[model samples]
Target: MIRIAVIGQSGSIPEEVERMAEEAGAEVARRGAVLLTGGGSGVMEHASKGAKEAGGLVIGILAGDRTDVANDYLDVPITTGLGFDFRSLILVHSCDALIMIRGGNGTLGELSAAYMNCKPTVAIETSGGWAEKVKQTAFEGCYLDERRTVEIHYAHSGKLAVDRAFELLASKWNEERNTGVTGD
Candidate 1:
């Protein structure tokens, strides 16, 4: 299954942002994709909740060994015990694409990781925080830096964000297949 990870802030968030996260998760499920997250609070919790409500599988890449800290909606918790920064890499590396919501430094790090790995990313601009800031500050409103390793896509709504991610994944898959890479 296509695995999509939603990365965002872990603390309290505005109600609308929560709703956006939920919609993104639900859209991921409706598209028959597995949802992955940092598995903490705030955006992670809300996304997991939405995925669960939609009967989607949720995987939480947790930083600590204690699954108790993971959100209640997780179908499986991969307790990495790798701490925040390292676990963030695991989250990025494990997913086919990433959906970014309102976030802080942690989210920025994840975005950087995605770029470095050439992983497809969709940022929900209307959710505010880095999701919004990244669009304005991105190089030519696309690449993060001069390297232009991978361009990040922006979406104004949750469903659109997920839709964009799927489109990106499909294109990437097609490109790999055309090149006879198999993408395994």
Candidate 2:
């Protein structure tokens, strides 16, 4: 199944931002994709909540060894003992695509990792935080830097962001298939 990770802050997010995160999770579930998260509160908790409500599998890539610290909605808890930064890389590598919501420094690092790994990422611009700031800071409004590793897509809502991510994944798959490349 397509695994989609939702990266965002770990603190108290605004109600509207929470709704967006939940909607993104719900949409991911509705589309028959698994939900992956950092396994903390705020965006992670809400996304897990939505995915569970929609009968979707939810995986939490946790930073520490305590599975109890993860949100209750997780179907599986991957306790990496890698701490936040390193575990973040595992999360990036494990998913087919990512949806970035309102985030802080950690989210910024994940965005950079996604770009470096050439993973498709969609930022919900209306959710504030890094998701909104990235558009203004990115090169040509899509690339994260001069390297231009990959272009990031922007959406106004959670549903749209998830949709765009899937579109990106499909486009990449089609490109590889058309080129007759077996692996990318």
Candidate 3:
């Protein structure tokens, strides 16, 4: 099972973008994939709601120990006591791949962390926010850094973005297995 984290804005997102995020989550669930999120509001809420409705497991990597703020749709809530900044790192580390929707600074931080850790990430570019900024800010269109640690793939729709994510993940795991252990 692939641990797919959904990174996006919390607290009141645009109506259309929120719907896109929900559709993304429903697609994730329908495909039998795990849905992970920061677990607040807006996009996260919609995603979790979609996943739950689709009978998929939803995990929330929350900023604090309190589960009260977490969406009702979550199957499990990881109460990361590290606050927002540090908890974001946990979200990146825990996932095999990530799907980014319309996001803010917090989502951007996760994107950077995913790049640093070589985790494959797919962005729904049509959603806006960091999804739009990343194409311009990335080191070489796709790469987040000059090291070529991980390159972000862009898709026009949530479904396509998820598809790209899985493809990248399979390719990445294959490379990791073939490369084996390296000293230098």
lDDT of 2 by residue, 47-162 (tens): 88998999899999999999999988899999999999999999999999999999999999999999999999999988899999999989999998898889999998889999
- List model 3 lDDT by residue over 72-174, tens digit each: 9899999989999999999999888899998999899999998888788889888889988899888888887678876788988777887888888777777
Which runs of model 1 end up more than 4 angstroms from their true locations?
A: none
Error of 2 at 38 (Å): 0.6
Task: Give, for candidate 2, the lowest lDDT window spanning 10 residues.
Answer: 175-184
Model 3 ranges with Cα > 4 A deviation: 181-184
Query: In lDDT terms, how accurate is model 1?
Result: 0.94
CA lDDT of every candidate: 0.94, 0.94, 0.87
lDDT of 1 by residue, 79-155 (tens): 99999999999999999999999999999999999999899999999899999999999999889899999999999
* Number of residue pairs clashing in candidate 2, backbone atoms closer than 3 angstroms, sequence gap of 3 or more or interchain: 0
RMSD of 1: 0.9
Model 3: weakest 10-residue lDDT segment is 175-184
